[model samples]
Target: MKKILIQQLFITTLMLGLSHNALAEDKKPATDSTPRQSTMIILDGSNSMWGQLQGINKIVTARESLKTLLENAHGNINFGLLTYGNKKKSCNDFTLVSKPEDYDKKKMLRNIRKMNPRGRSPIADALKQAAKNLPAENAHILLVSDGEESCGGDPCAVAKELRQSNPGLQIDVIGFRDEKEAQLECIAENGNGAFVVADNTERLKTLLDGVQAKARTIVNVTGTPVDGNLPGSIEVSIKSTHTGGTPSRANFSIYRPDGSNIASFTSRIQVKEYLEPGEYRVKAQWKGQSYTNKVIVQSGKTSTLRFDASQSGMLRLSSLNSNKEAVKANYSVYLANGDFISRHVHQDNVDLRIPADEYRIKADFDGTIQEKNISIEPNVDNNHVFRFE
Candidate 1:
């Protein structure tokens, strides 16, 4: 009887031990072998960053915004920094401040603060360089620029190339002003990313936070979220030139085939609306002109409508004296109907990206007034030098 009781107790003890061991094994944490997402921050160090907004220097605002981004970044994402035009005035002026790695707040902040804007904007090349440093196939590039490319590089084309070659890459751009907003839009659109305008510090911080989150919110230049939810979508883009367009400032209205109004909203470069699968008419009002196009939307798919608002060309104007030396002059641009487009003062040279049309240019050099009529053709560069007698 004693042996039987001891044997039964031993069996119970052995079973309990085995069960505990099995439970411990089941509770072990699983390991994740997937790599972290990486993002590269391409800061624009162009001289124009010295420009002020609401009495604060843009560079200062950018620095503060970046600090906020770093402080609030997620641990799963690794960030790298690349800056251009910060060291000196050169087209090739850019540096890889840091490589994509674990977020080092102190080190990153130190490098960001030490940067100063002093050079030209090499946006296209900077995009190329940033693409090369991407450690992982799935990566993001955030380009912060106050101006367009000064190196004569086509950033839009480069962005398209990067996106097409790497299916997982996305590029987002931030522009400070409305000047050349269309070009910035092109970069974002071609790169399969988003563009947001941050003219002030608060907006910059908010925009940076949103970008860091990797949660895509369809926002326009005004920072407003697009409103729509339906079965299908239509994307409308109106451009003055065949190569690039400024749909950001265009007004859009959509209608059904029966002539009933469906939606009306202003475009921020490109506007997309979700609707029931059907045919619709899209009209775009831009530069005091209206253009219309027809598109058919299919369920679970997005249709695109691109309107060629007008052909566009480049106009380069320079002021020179009889001695062939550059002289400061005031110039005003007007349409054929005498509508004023823009005015510049005391600039020896100015480049105008305008729709192909008849234009009247009035130049004043030390009170010597001159008027000229010129026609611009699509994709042509018209260089006109005003020589004062």
Candidate 2:
């Protein structure tokens, strides 16, 4: 009898221990297995933000719209703030007021409201500075500006350089109260982003809402398995055919079967996302070449897509007068078969990426057409100078 009682006590102790461990496991917090996205907002604190629209202060409108965006972005996105021309009249007036932290809405909104626009707009330098604060991949820069670059910096060139160096960084521009600023659009185009204009308070709020919605999509995990591995997913891989490696820069724009955009993200080599089981469209841009394809995803499975960049070379074209000094000229790129590719104006130096082949460039220096034929090799930077007599 004593031996049987001892055995029963041992069994009961073991059962109690197991039940305690099970309870502890159930109380643990759930974790998400997705990479977080980071964004740095470059606010245009230039004097123009203080301008008035319909008796409403532009700065007030910006602050209010940002407040709404921050409120909605709470707990969903990581945000940082960089501002220029807020305190003084110097070209180097930009400051990183807030570093990107996980959903710190209150701190970011406070910094935005305290901005006092009083100085010049060093847009180019500001953009470069903003890029430094972001991650090398899966990051964004939202540039809100009301005027042009007053500090003699080429914002377009800087934007292109930023994208080239950090292939994963996207630069978006919001032209507040100004629509005729072509340079702003150039900044967005070269930075692989969008340009939108807002002239009034209500419009500014609505536009900001749109931007925030896109931001959410960017930061949300797209191609990972869910808790139970029930949702479908897709992974994309980009590489170069010449080196058989990832290209220096590439852009991916994913769309639904109904032609609506799902997400536009940049990656040096690869990206993944989780979604519903369906057919999706993917458009990839690299080295001035674009390729589109379709992908299908099924439940509890991952669909893999691959894109290879063709052997392409870069042509740096410039024009000079009889004095060997740079001058404004119209340039056009054409294939050897006389097929036109594109055109540009007032670009002292333009970089054109073309497949490895023969090409012809025409430069119109104030109506005097100068033509030159050249050959481009794979992964080479070919420079050509058009000297007008």
Candidate 3:
């Protein structure tokens, strides 16, 4: 009887020990083997950053907020920095302040402290340059800007190009004290990222916290345009040029004369709005190219706008002096209905697209003015040389 009791006790003890070992194994934390993500901060150093926001200079506020954000960033993620408008007066001003690597808070903070805002805001150029600094795939970009692209480049087009080329690239935009929300939002949507507004330091910190969390996750991120309905009853028809055919996919933004967006559409063929009768700007993006034209709308008539992407021909203008040498000149283009289309100055050679039509051309070189009528045929390239003899 004593042997039997001892054996039973031993069995119970062994079972308990096995159960505890199983439980311990179950509670062990799983290891994460995902690759560390990278992020590039595209900072705007335009002169407008000097403007006051809540009675503090925006540049100063941005630097402080960025410093705080960087200090609190995750240790595993790599970070880089790029800035524009600080190097020169040209729109191509962009500088890579830091190459992406493991987080170094002190180094990033020092670079932020040295940024001085000057010149025009070249948001598009900055974005392109920042994209180059990131990995070819699955890289993240955070653009902090106080204004829109003051340079000639189209940020929306550039964003679209980056996204198409690198489907894994994400580009979030932070618009600080920015009034051009539509433009920034477009960039974010096209770049497969989010757009957030930060009016102060606290808000910026909160936003950066979210971004940091996003950077650490292993999930894929995507973006889409904001949902909204057209406001007006005016009918607008958008058609591709005769040669290019109709664009299967495109984005449109219609602005009032005062530059306020009245309507926007994504991947749409026609737009119907109740816009007031006046002149407006119609901007369209298709297949990485941007087109803009001034449109006149009548109260009850449907306005038709055509984009001459394929059917349009190139019109090149050049000037020569009495000695038969190339000289800079000014030129103006007018439509068949006598409406001025565009003007160029100080150009020795100007090349532009014009829809198939009969129109008047004018050129001025050293006070000599020449006017002539010419016809542009569809799918043709035409060159005109003006002699100032």
Candidate 4:
């Protein structure tokens, strides 16, 4: 009887062990296998976006196109909306309307509809802000602007800066009624992105479709081998393809294949250096902006990289009394559609770096209010005097 009990106990223990294993297997956690990608839509809210394109305002066309784009962007992708010139007139007029999260078409459309173009086009500042808002290391940016940088900011320089910080950042640009193709193209190139022109709503939709397609597609890069250099030594060259001019000076930070900082140097315009045959990360800074990229220096061959640079402008606001003399007063600026830009309190003069745009100025001198309209041109010092009678 004791022998029989011992055999039964062993069988029971074995069954319990098998049952525990089955329970543990059933409780295994599930994880998503899909890769996550992020895209920030930097929409232009400057007054220029209100201009007509094919019988409809640019803003309306953009909204419709974006609606379609978002509808198609449904997947494991995060979408965020950022707008410049929609809220205020200051050069720092960028607002993160929506934070990047799981794709939400309705929320994005609602936010886009709420935007009213009233301020200056601070394209560079917007780009800089996008860099900070996006948490993804390899984020994609889609900038749709009806005009060039209206605020005194260099979009190309900022794009280069973002590239330096995040080598995988891509910035695609859509120019709506923008005449400066080279400027927008330079921005795209600096961000290692694409540029497209949209003259009408149909074209805008087409361009957006292309952007979506590119976003969904994965790119496979294959490097070619070269000859002539010594073993473990490779030749590298840096080039500038900016529109305005070459950067005065550029600083480079090199990283080894093991992700350790190896060396750094400051150079001008184009730079060439001999490096070891391996994977490397390079960060270049120029004109207050940073750009980062990767290079696989193969033994015996040379690799050339390119950068871009652009220009900006400034605006000065001064106050005058009926006597044509400078006087201290409070000022309120607005876009043509009566949207508020900014307000300066009790100041005789205010200097601001702004993109080119038409503005309405309202001055309050000791409780008396006066209004005037002014237009600012790019690449020059725009001085506006508010005469309070």
Q: Which candidate has the highest TM-score of all?
A: 1
| Rank ordering of all candidates by lDDT, starting from the highest | 1, 2, 3, 4
**Residue 24, candidate 3: C-alpha displacement in angstroms:** 35
Candidate 1: C-alpha lDDT: 0.73
Please write out the lDDT profile of model 1 over residues 1-389, one tens digit for every residue.
99999999999999999999999987653345445557788998888888986777878877877777778664545788999998889998889888776456688899889888999999999999989888646588888777888899999999989988897787867777656777876787677665656664443443455454342121122332232222445667776653365544677787877767765655556665545656777777676544556788654345788877566678888888999899999998777666555678999788877767888898999999998998978779999999897
What total of clashing residue pairs does each candidate reach?
Answer: 2, 5, 7, 10
Error of 3 at 113 (Å): 1.1
**lDDT (Cα, tens digit) per residue for candidate 2, span 220-325:** 5474323232344566756775665744457777787776776565643444444556788877767676546689976545578987666778888898999989
Model 4 scores a TM of: 0.48
User: How high is the CA lDDT of each candidate model?
Assistant: 0.73, 0.72, 0.71, 0.67
Query: Judged by TM-score relative to the true structure, which candidate is superior, 2 or 3?
Result: 2
Model 4 C-alpha lDDT versus the unseen true structure:
0.67
- Candidate 4 residue spans exceeding 4 A from truth: 1-33, 200-206, 218-389
- lDDT (Cα) of model 3: 0.71
By TM-score, is 1 or 3 better? 1
TM-score of each candidate? 0.51, 0.49, 0.48, 0.48
Worst 10 residues of 3 by lDDT: 224-233
Itemize residue pairs with steric clashes in candidate 3.
232-273, 232-274, 233-273, 233-274, 234-273, 234-274, 244-310
Q: What is model 1's C-alpha RMSD?
A: 15.4
Highest-lDDT candidate:
1
